[model samples]
Target: MTSLFRPDVEALAGYTPGEQPQESGWVKLNTNENPYPPSPQVVAAIKQALEGRLNVYPDPLGRKFCQAAADVYGVDPDWILPANGSDENLTILVRAFADKNDLIAYPYPSYVLYETLAEIQGTRRARLQLNGDWSWDLQRNRPLIEQAKLLFLPNPNSPSGNSWSLDCIQKLVPPNGVLVHDEAYGDFAANPHRMELLRSEVGSQVVVTKTLSKSYSLAGLRFGFCIAQPDMIRGMRKVKDSYNCDMIALAAAEAALLDQDWMLANRNKILNTRAQLASELSESGFDVVPSDANFVWATHPVLKHQTIYEELKARKVLIRFMQFPGGIEPCDRYPDGKLDGLRITVGTDEEIQSLLKTLRVVIEDSPST
Candidate 1:
């Protein structure tokens, strides 16, 4: 039989999400999900939406949710386009801007999904490699930056959870391309929103995508949105699904954004736990990076990163062990090659304590480590 799929599609490796065990009793932390429950209002709104709402198609534009998000994020309703999730936003961006011949560039080792999404579009992809300290060589990458049609940056990058400065971010703006700030973990940072840049003259080239999964405790509810200039939003809007978000999700997302206090309280708790977790990991001979996100990236000085992840998993604890396909260029900070880390999500105090206990035992048992 003749193959119908494109050659690239046949060769492409789809993105692999973190392990989602079917059973319970697992200290699941591989995915960075909010351990706390969403705002009480979210539940009430969802219940209300369930009443006689399923029969009809949702608002094609998701107007109500857009207005609510606008109010919360202090942006105009037209400047935001709500989506099923941030992943959907990324897909739409690729579709809207790049094609098989065009180039899509992004900082490597930040979000692997960027690579997968670009590949799915059958577009040319460029990896702007990060240095050992998670910093970029702007001069070296300037040609790609200018040539790319889209550049995706996960602020407070994943697997590292380190944030670059505003000046550094500004330097990344392309003269002819769009810069996307994937602020998935922005809620846990001291300075999350970049409203000023979005409102500035250069705002025309910047797009910011956010999600409810991490901070709003709505990972189960697929809801996210992107903020950009009204013109850019309008352009991307045409690329998105007519009714990208369902009624239930719109209700939940609106309620979640409106209840800012609830989100803030949960964020504070996670930040605190993150601090403690990083300290403990450091004490255990791990090289912990100072993080602004809800998770810590720590490489062990003695034990192998994979060994730690496997041992912890055997004991029913889950944490992320990630290595970039192309190893990062070694710098003074990272002298030893093949640097990888355990990306542990900051869960509840009890859950984290249990993970630590098991991890300590695993380390002690591994004399070879």
Candidate 2:
């Protein structure tokens, strides 16, 4: 009659992801998912793979898929490590390097998954707060970096979708730490990717992780990967499961990567709609942070963030909300604390339009909000 979980697992509340409603009539714009179907070629490839085999195990090294990814990113096939998703890769990395009492650092109001993984790994999680403009504070973070063994940063950070410049990131390389850059939304950012940073001699500590989920619209298939020094890649390989990504997922990801035209076209569409959504929301009395990803972060200055979140949910238009203590207050309130607000993903033009229409109706109906 004893409990069967670790003390940390028992003590902590689990991470809450964006709302994914199964019921009909809800417009889900919470998870920053791409608003288009994957490439026609991807669909065809999955069908073809399914026709051939169901009985064999997948490639443990995931070489063919890795080669395709390397071809796209200009990295060596040996440096590429594919996983079920970036989430799985993150878990493996944490397990490989982090242990109880070991330290990991990240910019707060960033990816929640890092904190979740740290808790699960029984490692110490150091949360660095962002600056007023929603950028990293390198000077303040220098001490934390010097003390930590592993560091994770989401470029064009999640929920709050802004990024740091190459110069800014270069200055942040902790002398003895493995800096893992989660580039989940790098495809949509206005800046060049941190991949260039990885190529430099100064990039010994940096590793970049990407996903087919966002730009390629392959979230359902769960294909993602990391590019690191061969040693780091090998270390993660040592701890990973035998068959991490299935044959069908690998085939679909390969096809998706090859269909660059389709990918680029949809990215452009989402970018256009994202700009329009920010502008429209701003004009309607909402203060929106400029975003480089496929989502917009906004808050009504006069309206409580939670109230807005609940209101949107009641209307069946799902969006993400952050619930930090003191709730988006000045820095002194929570130095290592994450700030919270609403994260609304950019959908197709018609889908975004529907959301806009609902917002107008809700605001007009509830004058007090």
Best by TM-score: 1
Error of 2 at 204 (Å): 2.1
- What TM-score fits each model? 0.97, 0.94
lDDT of 1: 0.88
Clashes in model 1: which pairs?
none
Q: How far off is residue 152 in model 1, in Å?
A: 0.3
**Per-residue lDDT over 1-369 for candidate 1, one digit per residue giving the tens place of the 0 to 100 score:** 777988878788654656989899999898999999999999999999988559899998989999998898788899889999998999999999997888899897778889888888889999998888888899889999888888998998988899988778888888888999989999988887589778766789999999999999999998889999899999998898898899999989999999999999999999999988989988888888899898999887667789888989988999998886677768764665455778999999999999889998998887554
Model 1: runs farther than 4 Å from truth? Answer: 14-17, 367-369
lDDT of 2: 0.83
